[model samples]
Target: MKREMIEDALIQPTILLVEPDDKVRPSLMDNLHSWGYTLIVALSETDAMQRVQGKGEPFDLLLMNQVGHSVAELVAIGRDICQHAGLPPSIPVVVMAECYGDDLEGQDVQMGDYEYVAYLEDGQQLKELLYLLCPVP
Candidate 1:
């Protein structure tokens, strides 16, 4: 019998997480990492933008925590990054926030041109949303 190569194993999806809070960022990273995700943690929008600009390849998904920034700012940044990267305007972008219900009002934004769910209440919800956006191999 032939042995299977390590490369034959399924590869996990990569996610770019833009979260500013020190307390939340680590925990989120730990959880996602344990879940077999390749996480790129960016502390701020600027940092996140730099990473996206430098990386030659596009991430499977983008997870952003709208903590310090305004909704308009976040949306604009997200849109610009996707457009600059040549990714679809409807690329998967998961926005997590403490005041999502209120902050997200009138955003009229959808992930991949479909209704997007806000994973604000629970961390697991974010993971689930990511799975929906980009399935694990």
Candidate 2:
């Protein structure tokens, strides 16, 4: 198949990205957008919860930054709200952080259905994680 055709055929996953760092958030947004994914970004946990609960198509994945709350806590809380709101709680959640307790990669430190990733990793890695979690139809 031609390159454009292959690209066009790939599904664009919708993501709810929760990041508090001003420096990192914009870069991540730009990267996701350029990679052809639809993005809904939130800078705070409150905003992230509100967005997740509000009316819209269910997000394909949740990409969050490790800030005030732990990855597991965020996923648990978000999934609960999602369930109450009649949303799918199975969608993968990825937490981006500068450091973690041990050497872990995607799905290695999964809590429920969430995964942990180093925030400093390049966009290609993040994109791969999204594809792994929400594969194209």
Candidate 3:
């Protein structure tokens, strides 16, 4: 089936993307939008929270690129935002990182209501993770 046709079959799920880098946003947005996800790009934690709170509907998933800020900071802000919005902790979150080895010590990212996806890994791994999170119709 065609890509557009498949995307049309599923509900238009909203995705909150938190990435500081401007260069990566366009490509990521294009790829996700093609799959029928409504992308709300935020360059910082504050922007992300504002968009999430101000929006009419809560995002189906939150995707964060942990580059500019510390993981702890990101997790804390993310959790707080979700809590403030009265959203359950079970909401799926995908965190992108360079290295998510055993060294990172923090309950925020390690044992949270979200899932972790290593950004340094290959594209196939990322694709699989995304498929697992949001299956195609």
Candidate 4:
């Protein structure tokens, strides 16, 4: 098999991405896929809760690209989803923000900011952080 194909075949980490931006969501989704991550996209709060309530596999991470909510709000929403899903406690909740760096890397931050500008700034950075948290290997 081709190297790229073989790489794509690997099981990547699955994350629930809450992005309310109508214009930006698609781009973000495409980037996440290209970065070797599987994403469950939720365009709104209700939509996100519905997905969490569904009979589907629990996501490894909860990432929010806030348009209105604060970091605390993101964490609260993540907590709600975990409880509503009736799954394990403490699903890592990360709010993608303007300020971030290598310190947040490789850590499953629950209810905190992720250096989204840095990680999302580079696909390799995002991949590294997610892989460290989920560890497909």
RMSD of each: 4.2, 4.6, 5.5, 6.1
Listed in order, each prediction's TM-score against the native is: 0.75, 0.73, 0.72, 0.69
Which regions of candidate 4 deviate over 4 angstroms?
1-10, 98-124
lDDT of 2 by residue, 42-134 (tens): 787677667656565567777777777765686665566456446665766677765654445333345664544444445567777677776
Model 1 CA deviation exceeding 4 Å by range = 1-9, 54-57, 100-119
Off by over 4 Å in 3: 1-9, 99-110
Model 1, position 112: C-alpha lDDT score: 44
Name the best candidate (by TM-score).
1
lDDT of 2: 0.68
Residue by residue across 12-37, what tens digits does model 3's lDDT show? 76778887888888887887777667
Q: Where's the lowest-lDDT run of ten residues in candidate 2?
A: 100-109
For each candidate, what is the lDDT? 0.68, 0.68, 0.68, 0.68
Candidate ranking under TM-score, highest first, comes to: 1, 2, 3, 4
Count clashes in each candidate, considering only residues at least 3 apart in sequence or on different chains: 0, 0, 0, 1
Angstrom error of the Cα, residue 115, model 4: value is: 13
